[model samples]
Target: MAGNSDPLSPRAKLAVTAGKAVAAASRAAGRGSGSVIGGRVALKLDPDLLARLAQNLDCVLVSATNGKTTTTRLIAEALRAAGPVVSNALGANMPAGITSALAGGSESKFGVIEVDEKYLAGVARDTDPKCIALLNLSRDQLDRAAETRMLAENWREGLAGSKAVIVANADDPLVVWAASSSPNVIWVAAGQMWKDDAWSCPSCGGVMQRPGDDWFCGECGFRRPTPSWALSGDHVLDPHGSAWPIHLQLPGRANKANAASSAAVAAVFGVPPQVALERMYQVQAVAGRYDVVQFEGRDLRLLLAKNPAGWLETFSLIDPPPTPVILSVNARGADGTDTSWLWDVDYTRLTGHPICVVGDRKLDLAVRLEVANQQFQVCENLDQAVQLCPPGRIEVIANYTAFQDLRRRVGN
Candidate 1:
């Protein structure tokens, strides 16, 4: 295996060594937070480590309320046609994680980073990315991120001075408003399945008009921008009106939209549309979004849904009726302490389905399901929950920490 022996100044070299040692110790101690600590130590030692490592590389920074990790994986996979790409694939999306990824993969010629929504501007300013892909913005980590509109404002101010090309989602009014000021922008009509966050105009606080998939602000005169790249069913339409079929191993309309956004970013890097789509099909699982794993003698398909918007999209992918589903929730730091978002999800859609609630927040989920009149049993233990599931393939949808815990328990 290659070691992290990159050429750097004395202090940075020392910092890298210290960070790697810390990460190694953390892993040895069986702590899953090694990446987080390692990155923090590296940043503490050399504040400019991320920028220094990303200096001459063609970098693509992806940020959004959701789909950032999967989208980053898609973009990184497609960029293989160009050269070696370094990315933070471990789901650690902050500056520290990006630093660790770039510092560790020092030999790579390109960088594809999954940045947190709040840190996008700082990372972009530091790395001077070649392109920025702005996916949909929505309510996520309310305790930490506060509000979606505030994040949009931060992004708008941050990217205003950037010279990088912006690939933004036109279906989302917040994204449209954020990227509208960029000198070079490519609008993509990636479908937004959740519209609760974008109900009002970010510019003037007017109730947005939504007729089918098209949306416009009646008061501010803001509307969805015409997309240069769009997804029509399973086909991707190019800038010249030519359509190409996309086949992905990942499921959900959201993943298809992610593929479209990735293809647009790949185009900015001079990659052919066909090549980008081909590369995307090779990705079966991202981090742990969609993966079939064997747990307690049952084949469990893992789906991670962090918030209400995420749960809404994930619930759509579940097979209705007869198919048994496991829903898990946790109130850990990574999963967000407040579980109030549970009320926002439309659990009524699963009224007739066989549902099993599991995890620390299983009671909270059960309460929501009961209020929606959905019949479900509480199973705090995932192993027991799998055993109780109906005879057939079982699907497990879990929030942040719940998903990670299950993944670790199942040895995935």
Candidate 2:
């Protein structure tokens, strides 16, 4: 219950010190980055540490089923143009990890935090961010996280009391329903490509209606709001009728939408849209998501996609046909033990590409790819798959834990 500007209680100060020590020890032990474990230790000692540390900083929280990490990085980098900014840039997004990131950047003038979908409400309550970016919502980690609509309703209810200006996606029905009733909201037509989870209205439980550029409930008349900012083809048009070209180093239309919402969030803190985006032109990757690591004359590019919606977006980012893409999957706790979601992905999109599968759940992927009438080779690991084909740019796509394995192997 203490603020950063206010004198910290002796107990709280001790907890912060202990957390840093543990994080340092974790690095020395070579266990991991120690962000999560360090914060866990701090939370056990003082549950109010996040609130105390984040109280005085102007924070921006970005939450979604995908793109949270990259968008957070963009917003934080953009804010660097205005002043000093700190963020959970490595994707340690929960409360404990959030605390750890803020712990080290006490002198930062701004805070940009990425929040997991279910944890957004609590983080917003503590940080009371100046602006909150609500991107699209889709079925992700259904076995471990809440159901799609349930998560949206929770967001709707939890955000009712928030004073932060909400910058929400107008194209996503779930995000629209959640942020609609808020007193302050800036709508951006950031797209939602996978409509499987959004066909039903969150408010009325009716089939959604899409008559051209707009969506409304077939039964209840809850319609999509007009966006103040929209991603029009390759350009992002702001409220003043000014259009900025979207020439980002990050690939895909999904990230273009991220750039739109990010510029909107940054503008809330007095940074111009073009100024913010110009600063982000240097970012080519985020936490190794779109990293290129070349070895043995094989140009290997790593791409991470955890769910059906994510896979759909990732397919657009991979190189052209016969590029020899290695598909990997895992059913670890981090990736949700149930691999049933694999059925929803249309693997046939990789028809012309030479596909090689690997990971703990490679068998599941093989079956799914088979049923889709697509040809794929099941392999043991990245090297085995790469050896089978003549590769220039080898595309590697994996889920959460599996992606971490690939990252470690490449020394990323």
Candidate 3:
């Protein structure tokens, strides 16, 4: 948020006003939250609007291919215990969305900014965050962006001069390699669900050696760092090995991992570990990720899984057995233009379940499901998909844009 003691320059103020007006107009027109365009206009007027707004902020930037939005939201909610907090609660991690988020919370004391992996360096350079959380890196937007190791190298090079204490996940090889270059780092043993992307070492390009929870490149002797905070079973363990069981409304192991990372970041901001965990429990959902919406007597729960890594985590959270599953996918600008990522995910996990596919790329998904021997029926829309199922609990898992489309269709 912009500081009260240090007000914005006149031109900057005009840009903020214009951005807010555009955002409000966007909301009224039902065009969508105007954070992107409004902030884009604001940046055009004041190219340094983000840097200027974030000048006095105690920012913590979170970047990961998956769980970034949820982790950012969890950290922001916990930081509220300290004081007014500003964050991109709407899952807008880019420059324009971030600008709108910071502008909205003018008097916020702390900023929890969710950043895209591609823009992490620039955002860190602009915000000068007090702490930076680098979650696991994996295959995402394969058609549009670099792989995990290359992206990790960019993180290593771009953040070489940063003074922020890096809160990195030691369980991920890519994250460890990137954060190892930093001057100050607080490692957390956050579990990694997917390992296909990190098979080759980032430092030496050798086959990674995995002995239980530890990973190292035998060629270069590059290994995982001992974490200050670790997740032991269902409990979160601190540096002293004292564990606290986390009770949260949000489901999935990914979210639990996110909670541990958020708690660690909150502690850096002066919020006690227990206090941060307790505050995080009060949050029932993050930008409709775990929302349960009722549609025609059946409870339709929403889940977002954009990439294979995300799908693996999300699949675990889905109800077992006869509980029907709705799989949605798209190749929109947000969900990557290439549909090749569909093959990376093993659809055989849904073998026994009644599967229904719906999305712009539903046919692509159907073809994949066919080869996996997972029988599925394609539906044109969510209503039709749910109509085909008996009234009970329905799990709707969708990619980026498809998830938003489902929310709008359900009036979420």
- Write the residue-wise lDDT of candidate 1 on 165-193 in tens digits: 99999999999999997999999999888
Error of 1 at 71 (Å): 0.6
User: Against the unseen true structure, what C-alpha lDDT does each candidate score?
Assistant: 0.88, 0.89, 0.90
Assess candidate 1 and give its TM-score to the true structure: 0.96
Predicted structure 3, TM vs. truth? 0.98
- Give per-residue lDDT, candidate 1, residue 390: 58
Clashing residue pairs for model 2? none
- In terms of lDDT, the best-performing candidate is 3
lDDT of model number 1: 0.88
Looking at model 3, report the run of 10 residues with the lowest lDDT sum: 1-10
Q: What does candidate 3's lDDT look like per residue over 104-173, in tens digits?
A: 8877889999999999999998998899999999999888889778899999998999999899999999
**Residue pairs of candidate 1 with colliding backbone atoms:** none
Please give, for residues 69-151, the per-residue lDDT of candidate 2 as tens digits.
Answer: 99999899889998899899999999999999998887788999999999998998888788999998988886898998888
